[model samples]
Target: MNQDLIQTFIEETEENLQVVEESLLDLEQAPADQELIDLVFRAMHSIKGGAGLVGFEEIGELAHYLENILEEIRQAANPKLPDDIFNLLFAGIDLIRQMIEDNDLTAKSVGRELTELKKAIKHYQLVTQEGSSDEQTIQQQTGQKYYKINLKFRETIFETGTDPLMLVLELEEVGTILASYLNREQVDDLFHLNPHLLLMNWTIFLESEQSLDKIEDIFIFVKEDNQIVIEEISEELEQWFSGGEETEKLLRKEEFISNVDLDQVLAKQEQIGESLFLQSKTTKEETGQADKQVRNLHKQKRTETIRVATDKLEGILNDIAELLIAQSRVKELATGIVGLDRSLQSEIVNSFQEVDKLIRRVQEEVMSASMIPIGDTFTRLKRMVRDIAAEKEKDVKLVISGEDTELDRKIIEQLADPLKHLVRNAVDHGVERPEQREKLGKPPTGTIELDAYHQEGSIIIEIVDDGRGIDKEAVLAKAKEKGMIEQESQLDDSEIYNLLFKPGFSTAQEVTDISGRGVGLDVVMSNIKDIRGNVEVFSEKNQGTKIKIKLPLTLAIIDGMIVRVGGERVVIPLNSIVEFIDASKQQIKQVEGKGLIVSIREQYIPCMALNELLQLEGSFNNLKEEPTGVLIILKDDQKQIAVQIDEVIGQEQVVIKNVKENMGQAEGIAGATILGDGNVALILDVPTLFKLAKRLKVG
Candidate 1:
């Protein structure tokens, strides 16, 4: 009932569900893998137990049913499950996720689906049982075993939010209790006892058809701190039962025969206990040393990682940004102090330099803390691809690489939708059906690869598919039909490919549920651009399509090149700048169609004066008019353009401040940063800048 406990349960359950989902995917490929099977079973078991602890009976029931199915599969002679069963398991996971998200104790939102899923699971159990009846009978006859389990739990177990009774209940599920004894020797006087402390132990004799390993697993969650001893008493019980009529009567009475003098059996039990005690003594000595090492490693790991709220991290970053600005102001004021001692000034400069280094280090560490691996996102994508492939009846496989590449958590969070749209587009439109692939001399199963890696100063994510590539003519034809492009417009391959991102653009011959609503790619572009990133498509007919997205490592800070554009100082991302050229060294010409073109080497690129493009005041309108003006060439994946500026200031790392809330969207302006002297400089969005220049020519 505690809110904190519920939250902890939810977090832990979510993690276990992820494990279950991923393990199921793996098990689908290698069905006979015992380790994968156990992994999934353990995850599901943990979820079920946690749900019970949190009083979510609906969740607990669903997980319990799914756990039973997993147990059946684990025990089956042929481990490979039918596709329907896998589908059922995936659906169950989805339902459980929905219930958790809804957090409705009454389960009103998912009642129908929950009922249908339970029915399907029950049907599966009946069918499997019918098919394996003979095997089950054989196992029941020959595999029956008895285990004597002694459970002495830690007195402080209740404080950990664990009920010792839960373990007993779980053991009951695996087998039947032939006899159980409550050991209350540890109990204190009732008046003096702490009610919260667990003081009772259980000694149970169980009859089960499961393996010893399976029985041992029932105690896995508690065995670490508890004194649990399990021994096979099957042969001993059988011998005693066959020895005399009196033993048979004792069994028939269903009572403990405490007065019976079975010396051999008692001696055997005592000798075995002593032998086990000695063995455990030796094992404990070794375990004690290993436990110390493990504890040290765990302590180090705990210190290395701690969970901090995102808002708190953002606050730290904001404070650090303020400190950086203050440090710069102090340095600037120190330089202007007249009649200061040379040594003192030198010391002051060195001290500021040290502060700069320290601040940069701390900034890097904080940013690193906000980064998480993209593997989780990729895992979710894998599931999406599986479901979509199934829905469309296409044989598609998603291969992932560089999933461990870390990205800013905020960026990664916003990235999911865009990536999902692109991936769905790939599966729905890019990949061909199995029969079509086979007819085209390709493997029936198509492959879609999701890859991520760091390139230059940005993170590049590429989704590539080995399917029928983007049909350029179809795209261009659609564009023409939709009046998105001029009918007679001359365009190259890249230009044709770019048309896919035009709003309301679709090349599909007919509409389907998956795509062809003329809605996906444009949204993908808009979303990526919103994060100051760009998306590009590359394709060759019949070879496949590759969509690559380039994004900054973090949105907080970046290394930028400051340049004077008229009276205002602008920050251009250093990664986008190809080179700086002197206007005097280049042959600047006014080509009739190209407007202004600057010749570098043998290639001519379009040129635009920043002051002219931005319509800034106080500087010459043309680059040729200012003798000291320079041109900075910037390149994106598709095109390159030269922007004319007054003078190049030094480069510096600046913290980005979002100005969209106050200023609204500004064309070609990504964000603004505070300069050392307290002035705000606008950062240019390179891709948009290139587009603006192209539009200027048309005007």
Candidate 2:
């Protein structure tokens, strides 16, 4: 097999598996839905056929059994499915996924699990068939019909190890082969022939009571490489064959066709093949070449786009970044030149401006291409919640919103594990059982909502549940018991709730598969923070718990407001800055020895000197020393704080380079960027700065 063909098969199989997983989740909710059943059956059936073509026998077998169960259900023989059936099917899905990932088909690897699933399926099918005798009887009343199948194998079919004889054998299992015509005129003489090449076509007249879907399934393994045309010809085909002399039916002794008629049809097919072959052989070589060129041009016109590897796109971005840095340096040099011609300087500025615009446009296009919807991650979470709920014997419904919202590919890739942990936590610890919920006058089915939306150039994801909220008392007791917090520590409700994220701080009575090793939420927080994001929890006694995470739009670049903190430069994200103000002495008042509070728009906001917060040398320690210090009013969602600075420089779009990799996460700093003058300025994390200011005020 070609490497490209293998990669394409892997990508397509994974996509179809996603559909299968989603449809199974939907079927768990609406067991009687025919469309959902069909969707799942089709997805699994496709995977089975495709995997067989690629020689992944384990995946093909798993999908085949799973598809069989779904087919029985669709036929109304298994109306009241047992809950265990879903488990078996889910196990089949996992088994197939693992096989695809490892590319293994050894019997020792998946034989036990495969046997268990098949056993359960066979048992259920037997029981269901016993009760569905009447349905089977009605199905048999639909008499057998004849189908004419024309199969022309692609020239390269032998390369894929596809034996046309196997397909014919499969057809024989379904019905009687009345007559057949084999076209082998394309076969060359033994001296010139390619032994591994396929040069034959087959036309078969088959009589079976099976539906067209079943007939199509016979050739599903080779249908893509072989042209298969199946049509119902029970009525019209008889008249055409009745006029010709037939011959002996070597394969079947059925009365459908006599020997004389079969011989006559074979003779006619040979004459037709010879005439077409001779006509093609006599065509001028130039004319044939011209026709081939026209076909190639037509194919090129049809395919307008092609897939490019991610690394190639990353290379383009790296070149663009370098170009941007050089552009900045040229602009800075242009500004510093003295005694230059005014017109030439002006043209240089204009040209730089135009280049800047073009660079931005290119950056946007590349970023847009790199973005994909968060829906795939959301779907995976839904399946996780469903499986966990089933295991825990809970009735839960997951509602998702803003699934079409797109995010940077890098951000989305790291998002899956964190999101999975959060959802599993919700299912295991937050949601109450049906019995408990009914006693509390709530709906028997609990609801968990997964939502995502864009806010101020960031993506906010919230997981909200309608189960019994976090037990603050239990959390506090656990913290005290684990020596995580002092017994006399003064903690508010938010602080108490936040203790859930402390390492090894779980309150569950015992460890289970879902959660309770006390490692999930802390990992969630750490993962979110690695992307320069934050997660907060809110809960009430009986209402529920909500975990909201805020992440940046992208990892590489952002628009920032550059400012001076007593001669040192720093960058604050533009999205977080509300406005700048020149605060006078009287407006800044100290509360005891704590930080200053600046009055803005009739509201008092905590004010801290940026120099003091960052603790830098050669910085103003006192806010009142300056006649009128600049105050940057920053907001993070609903919280606001003021950072007093010496000067407010202009804003610019800066490329963010990670500082944590070298500096290891500085306080009040998210990352660093280069100024136009080639100076490195630290990017301030507004949320962290707000928290620092609050601690300063409370001290």
Candidate 3:
């Protein structure tokens, strides 16, 4: 196979398998839904075709077996898909996914899974037979019903190379045809007959337990070219001659019979659309619209899209970053020339401003190119939640919103592990068993909502679960026992919740496969922090726990307000700053152990001198002394605090350089950015700054 073709096959096959898995889950809820059954069948069919083209014989065979079961269901009048069948299907999907992941082609690698799936399929065949027998038994054990199938082939059917007799032979495979009438009223004499045209029509009385779908399949090849209809004439066949039965054609797109007057019969057979509407428990229009949407979605998927290697995107981003750095340098040089003509200086500033605007535009375009929807990751986590909840014997449902929210591909890749950990922990430890939840007046099915959105120039991912909320007392006790906190220290709710992120501080009584070793949450925190992000935990006992993670929009560049703490210059992301305030001693009042709270606009906001928070030498440090200069009001979402700074040194777009890559993560610092004057300024992480301020006041 061509390498590019093989790559496309693998990617497409993976996507089809995901659709199969998700559709299978949906099928478990509505086993009789024709659309859902068709969806699974089509997905498996697609995978089989793709795998066969790529020479993945084992994968193709496995997918074909699964597809066969779906085909049987689709053909049956009613399909009873027990939980075990769905389980088998899910197992098969997993096996296929593993094969694709490993790119396994050897027979030895796929033989075992293939055998197991074959056995499951064989068992499914037995189940389908039993289901059919049970249906017949419920119908009073009657031998069989008779269906009158009449097919009137158009005169051009022979031109279309259709053989009407072959369709009769195919119908015989489904049932016993007691009588077949060849309607040739419109046929001319042999001398004037067109040998290339079809003139005969068939009216057969078929008796069998087969479904309409099976009977229809026999004539599917010529359904559009012929007028065929089938009607249930089980007991009415004898009455049909007495005007008691409704006789219809096998296919009914147009009128075919003119001389044979059958006024008692209905005009046409029931359409697949009407049958699907009845089976789907939805309106016919809605079903049709849903199918249209699915087709449109597939059409969009088929629309040409090329996959670019991640390293190339990274290279482009790095170049953009360099361009930003050069742009900053030019701005510095534009203003540095002394005794220059005023017009020349203004023109230079204007030119650099335009360059800056263009550079920002390019930066945004590149970033957008690197962004991908988080829905795929969400789908994987949903599967994990389902499997883990099953293992733990807990009933759980994952509700996902904002799945189309896009984020940097690299950040999303790093986010996968942490997201998985959070979901697993929620399913395993947070949600209660069905009985426990019922006793607690909660629904037996626990709900876990995964939401993502943009806020304050960052991405906020929240995992909220209506389970047994975090036990703050238990967390506090765990921290004390682990020697992570002073036993006498009184911590607030937020402080207690934050202890869950401390290394090796778990509240679980014993370790399990899912969590409880205290490693997961800390890793989640570490991973988020690695990308200049923060995780906040909120919980109310017996209610639920909501974990909100805030991450930067992109790691490359940011609009920052440059300020000087003392001799040290720092950059604060412009999105986080609300305003600047000047305060005298009257506005700042010390509240004993809580330190100073500045009253601004009738709201009491915490105040921390920048020098004290960073532990640096500054002009202002002592709270007892009258505070002066500008107090920058910084708010990160709901948390707000006033930072006493020397002065605001204007704002500029800064290219972010990862400080941890060289200097390691520093407290209260997000990353470093180059200044117009060529000096390096540390970008302050607003969330971290709040924590530091709290600590400084507590001390």
Model 1 RMSD, rounded to 1 decimal? 7.5
* Prediction 3 global C-alpha lDDT: 0.75
Q: Count backbone overlaps in model 2.
A: 11
Arranged by TM-score, best first: 1, 2, 3
The deviation in Å at residue 472 for candidate 1 is: 1.8
lDDT tens digits, residues 261-348, model 2? 5566655534533432221112111211222222123222334456677777777776777677677677778877723656677778
Clashing pairs in 3: 228-249, 228-250, 228-251, 229-249, 229-250, 229-251
Q: How many pairs of residues collide in each model?
A: 0, 11, 6
Per residue, candidate 3 scores C-alpha lDDT tens digits across 224-317 of: 4468787765544433332223234322332443445333123222221122221211111211224323322432222455678778888988
Highest-lDDT candidate: 1
Relative to the true structure, candidate 2 reaches a TM of 0.82
- Of candidate 1, the 10-residue stretch with the lowest lDDT total is 279-288
The Cα RMSD in angstroms, rounded to one decimal, for candidate 3 relative to the true structure is 10.6
Model 2 worst lDDT window (10 residues): 279-288
**Residue range 434-467, candidate 1, lDDT tens digits:** 9999888999999999999998788999999999
